[model samples]
Target: MEDCGEHEGTSELKLGTTIIAVEFDGGVVMGSDSRVSAKEAVVNRVMNKLSQVHDKIYCALSGSAADAQTMAEIINYHLDVHSIEVGEDPLVHSAATLVKNMSYKYKEELSAHLIVGGWDRKAGGQVYATLNGILTRQPFAVGGSGSFYIYGYVDAEYKADMSREECQEFVINSLSLAMGRDGSSGGVAYLVTIDSETVEEKCILPAELPTFYDPDTIES
Candidate 1:
């Protein structure tokens, strides 16, 4: 069984089932599968991995479910307080920095991977990831156990200047492909798209698999 959280000197943490984000010409697309597992067993099938911090800012959580939820709540609360005091929402970069700091502070105890992305008034749209206390800005990012499969599709299909529609399709196809191959990943899919002017969200049902027929069964 894989350890989901850090304890004493344990450094390994279970990855979330699947979460992916892609950057396009004007915005970013983030998607996650709704599956949670414990070892070889599926514990929950409707877990949401994507969180909305504000109207414009959002994040995808991967790793221990408890840790991810707790950290998300903490970050949301902090952002809420900051907005109330400053009379405006923080930029996407600032939000990523805040999460990076918190992750670093609790690096020893918490085992959560975060991908933050959103539209910034000054910087337009951006995405960033936090891993083991280090924060990196990425053109595209994938997390969880199925990330390897997701990356395969993304690397082959992603373009530097894809249209918003194209990017959305790419994200959906990548996630569906991942779910099909990764045993630990499957369920409903949640997608969020963020641009300079608006943030849009959509929910996608699991893809239907095609029926396979054996050639040997056919009569000549």
Candidate 2:
């Protein structure tokens, strides 16, 4: 923790999962499904699932939903505070410091697992997400039930070499693949990208199912 908030101490909780990120082309995309099931039964409570903070960035998280929500609120407040003080886009690093502190402030039992992405005005491009236990940014990150699968597919496929549209397609396809294989994940997805203007929202694309054909028509 480079700089954490004032608190007695705090720990983290892992709850519903998610996958999200910033891409090479200065855009952002986030994805998460509405599946929190066990033993074929599901949790009845509704969660925000995925959202944008500061109107300039997007986030998806896995951990204590309660904690994640509160942290998000604090982050929103901090962004406003910075905007007023600096008269410019809030620096992601400043947001990180605030989240780090807030997490510790509420660290006793309610701690969130989070990932955030945005456009860094100072850097003149979109910033990727990193996982350091705070609301800070990273180059690439994934969360949620299918996160491991989500990360695996994209990590291998994503390249600074790919075009913005190409990267977006890869992310969409990767998420669909994750939903298909992971029982705890399903439903549609939402995505985004942040640049100077911020591409902050996109519709989720469901996984592609293989087509079935008549056996007689098969070339094999």
Question: What lDDT tens digits, residue by residue, belong to model 1 across residues 18-115?
Answer: 88887776678898888887766788887778999877888898878888888888888889999899998888887888889989998887878889
lDDT string, candidate 2, 172-216, tens digits: 676667766666666566566566764656664343422223447
Model 2 regions lying over 4 Å from their true place:
1-14, 36-40, 43-48, 104-108, 126-137, 198-200, 205-220
**Per-candidate TM-score against the hidden true structure:** 0.87, 0.73
Candidate 2 versus the native: TM-score? 0.73
Q: Which stretches of candidate 1 lie over 4 Å from their true place?
A: 1-12, 208-220
Provide the global lDDT of candidate 1 against the true structure. 0.79
